[model samples]
Each structure stands twice: as C-alpha cells, then as structure tokens.
Target: MPDIDDFLRNQERIITTRGWAVTHVLPTDDDPDTTAPFAYTVGLTAHDHPELIIAGLPPLVAHTLLNDLARQVYDKAERFSHGQRISDLIAGYDAVIIDGRPTDDLLPGAAIARYGRLRIRLQQIVWPDQQGRFPWDSGYNFDPHIQPMIAHL
Candidate 1:
C-alpha cells in the first residue's frame, strides 16, 4: 500500500526479463499487530502453478526464500500441495504447504496488478516455531498473530 507503483513497475521489469518476479511486503496498517509480515511471487500461476506465500519472516528473508522456492516451481517444475512437509526450505524446522486465500489486504498490490485483480490462489509455506511446533500444535509458544492460520484449499 505504500506507493507500490514503483515496486510493481520494478517487478514487471524483472518478470519480463527473467520470466518471474518475487515481491516482499512489510507489515502495514492493514496488517494488525497479530498478523505477520509476508512475501509472495507473481509468476508461478502462469506456469500452471499456484503462487507461493510465506508469513512471519522479515522482508529480506522471505524474499530470499521465495526466490529459491519460485525457482523450484518454475525452473524445476516442482509443485507444492496441501499437507506436504518440506524440510529443505528452512533450517532445522520443517515447513508445511497449505492453501491460502488471496485477500486484498493480505496480498500486495504487485500480485493484484500482475494478475489483473483476479482471485489468485496461494500456497503458504508454513514454518514451525523454534520448538518445532506448528501453529495448530499444542503448546505452540510463538505468537498466534505472527502467522495467520491458513483456511485450507
């Protein structure tokens, strides 16, 4: 929401030249204290794949992770589906892939602009807390708002 025209323009150039683009979004007014910062991709859907989304990470961290994941999806044709646990994405703790909704406030303007405001489906790369406990796990110590719960596909 913070004058993302420049961001979108930059992303458009990246996608046009490199065949894909990754965008990181910091926490904004629309994102309350309970919601964590998130990052997303804008090109996988065009390859018959769902765009990737990750929460509870800093902009740079999420951007780096999304680039690796996007490469897997785009270059290697790797596809992430619901309930799949992936250990290679993050160190120590594993991540689960789950369905995510494309709410206007949660996803950035870059995504909306890239896909013409359509309801873009998202697949969340849900990482676990330090104790290896996911949000739905009992005794999870991390703040619930740090990662919004996925509604499932």
Candidate 2:
C-alpha cells in the first residue's frame, strides 16, 4: 500500500495546481474507530462553486490525499433516470488518484450501498481502451460481493 502521507501530498499538489477545493476525513488509530475513516471528497468550479456531498468523512486530522483525482464513475446503466449518481453529487469534482491502491473490502460498505440503489458502478479513473494513451487501465470498481454488507451502512 502507498503511504497515506504521500497520497495526501499528491492531493494537495493537485489542489494547488488545479486550484480546486478539497475536503478530507481522517480516522483514529484503532480499527473501526468510533472516529470515522480517512478519505477525501473534492470538487471544482469556476468561481461560485457549490458544495459537494460525500458520506463518511472522519475528522481532518491526519490522512492521505491523492494528488491525481482517481475517476470514480457512476454508470448510468447501473441506475435509473432521475436517480442519484455519485457524479451528480460531486459534479465537476476530480478525485484523488489512488497510488497504493484501495480494495473493495476496505471501503465503507454502507456508504457504497446507498449508491448501489442507483445501480451505480464505481470505477477507477482510467482512459477508455479507445483513447490509447498509456494503454493502462485506471480506476477500481466495487464488485457484487460488497452488496450484502452495504445494507448495514
């Protein structure tokens, strides 16, 4: 896993260069700390920007922030029209890219379940095969195994 500090630094760099607002939640040391987990929800706007909504942000004490915003796409196919999409809530927001990599198991299941109702497919930020730039795939998506746990979230 990539060091959390490095991740946060990368995110800070992106915010500095791109000039976007970032929000992060930091967790306590204990596993499943009553304190919440460390994560960030970032958004961008020209000038008068709106607030972005994301769930399960702990305190902003110490946490990792990714410099490159990893794209987390919510596939429309997964959701019904007029349904909630992660993109809609955080529109124009860029995600901090995950360098070390995050696993589905580590993510908050409840929070993810909320999105699933919309049939959302949370995928990592990556260029489509047709784009053919680095030819490397980006983004890690949630798999079905996580579904059962979301109800509790």
- lDDT per residue as tens, model 2, 46-123: 222211222233234112222223222111112121122233322353222112122433342322332332332222
RMSD of each: 2.8, 13.7
TM-scores for the candidates: 0.85, 0.26
Best by TM-score: 1
For all candidates in order, the CA lDDT equals: 0.77, 0.30
Candidate 2's C-alpha runs over 4 A off are 1-13, 21-23, 30-32, 41-46, 56-83, 86-153
Summed backbone clashes in each candidate are 0, 17
- Per-residue CA lDDT of candidate 1, range 20-79, in tens? 787776756875664568888887767777888888888888888888888888889988
Question: Model 1 off-target regions past 4 Å?
Answer: 1-4, 28-35, 117-119
Task: Write down the worst ten-residue block by lDDT for model 1.
Answer: 103-112
For candidate 1, list the clashing residue pairs, or say none.
none
